[model samples]
Target: MLNRVILIGRLTRDPELRYTPTGVAVTQFTLAVDRPFTNQQNEREADFINIVTWRQLAETCANYLRKGRLTAVEGRIQVRNYENNEGRKVYVTEVVADNVRFLESANREPASGGGMREEAPQSRYGNQRSQQQDPFSDDGKPIDISDDDLPF
Candidate 1:
């Protein structure tokens, strides 16, 4: 069985970070994902998804990410049942983030006597080499390796 989800969207609001009773860091936020197709009026639709991050990733998201920041998240979908104040059963669904990637550099305030510089790239998996240029530049292009050339 496979249960996986990949989403690239903008945050609708700033991440809310808090610590559990045991001092475990946790963060929750909503992401606005635009639909691939347009509506009847040719307007793009968006879905607000709830995401939860834990531990170090949670702290990083809350510290760096903010409203309208584009982000890429990889995680699994979870559903749970709970009781509300009126004793009604409620079903909740959310994404439990395993990893998150900041997609854009935060705009920095201009420094005196200098132009604005791009912020340094940061990632949970260390500084990732920027692939913004062309993630699949080699696709359908000439390649030196062939199936028969494989050692396996």
Candidate 2:
């Protein structure tokens, strides 16, 4: 048996982070992915997918991800059932993300003195990255990356 799913899309809203009673971090968010084909009316359609992250990755995602930011999510599709307030069974299908990649950099604040990445996104492990749109430089250019910065 095999179960896997991968998607690249923009965030429909900011990820909501919370901790369990044992201090386990968790985050939930929705991703808006456009369909490859347009509708009959010639308008593109999008699918809103639910994503869930756990542990350090959850914290990283909540801290760095924001609405409208493009991202890639890799995970398994999960379906669970629960009882609602009216005593009715409700089923939810969501992606349990194991890996997430930030495809866009956050807008930098002008007050920053250096051309450093203000909002770097990391994985379960901490990683720092920066791109175009610097606040310290007048041109707002992306800072150069050293070969050492690449994780291979």
Candidate 3:
């Protein structure tokens, strides 16, 4: 069965990191995702989705994610039930995120006033990596590629 889900939204609150009895790291956060269409009142409504990440990803999320930060989550849907203290069965549905990406840079605000050139992307893994020059990013000057360059 297929159970993959991908979502892009802002965090409703700061991530909560905790450790289990086995010393495993876990983080839980909520993502506020706005529905595609507006309601009759022309107001956009948002859904708060619970997300859980484990191990290194959990720690990474806890360290980097903050409230109202835009992020992309890739994971699967998990639904589980437990008995409450009041003898009621409570069902919980959460996304067990395996991969989470920060859409914007931690140092830069999304809507800074002054117009500035866009910077290369950064990942949670490493520092600014040197991006290979894109052939299309030049001054509209085309590189001469001879027929000999084609192996076929």
lDDT of 3 by residue, 42-132 (tens): 9999999999999988887897788987788889999999999999999999999987877656753663332222223333443355666
Local accuracy of candidate 1 as per-residue lDDT tens digits, 43-72: 999999999999988988898888998787
Question: Model 3: what TM-score?
Answer: 0.74
Arranged by lDDT with the best first, the candidates are 2, 1, 3
Give the Å shift of residue 70 in candidate 2. 0.3
**lDDT score for residue 71 of model 2:** 79
Tell me the spans in candidate 2 whose CA falls farther than 4 Å from its real position. Answer: 108-124, 127-152
Local error of candidate 2 at residue 78 (angstroms): 0.3
User: Considering TM-score, where higher is better, how would the candidates rank from best to worst?
Assistant: 2, 3, 1
RMSD of each: 11.2, 9.0, 6.7
Using all chains and alpha carbons, the TM-scores for the candidates as numbered come to: 0.73, 0.74, 0.74
Residue lDDT tens for model 2, 12-47: 999999999999999999999999999889999999
Model 1 ranges off by over 4 Å: 108-121, 125-152
- Top model by lDDT, which number? 2
Give the TM-score comparing model 2 with the true structure, all chains together. Answer: 0.74
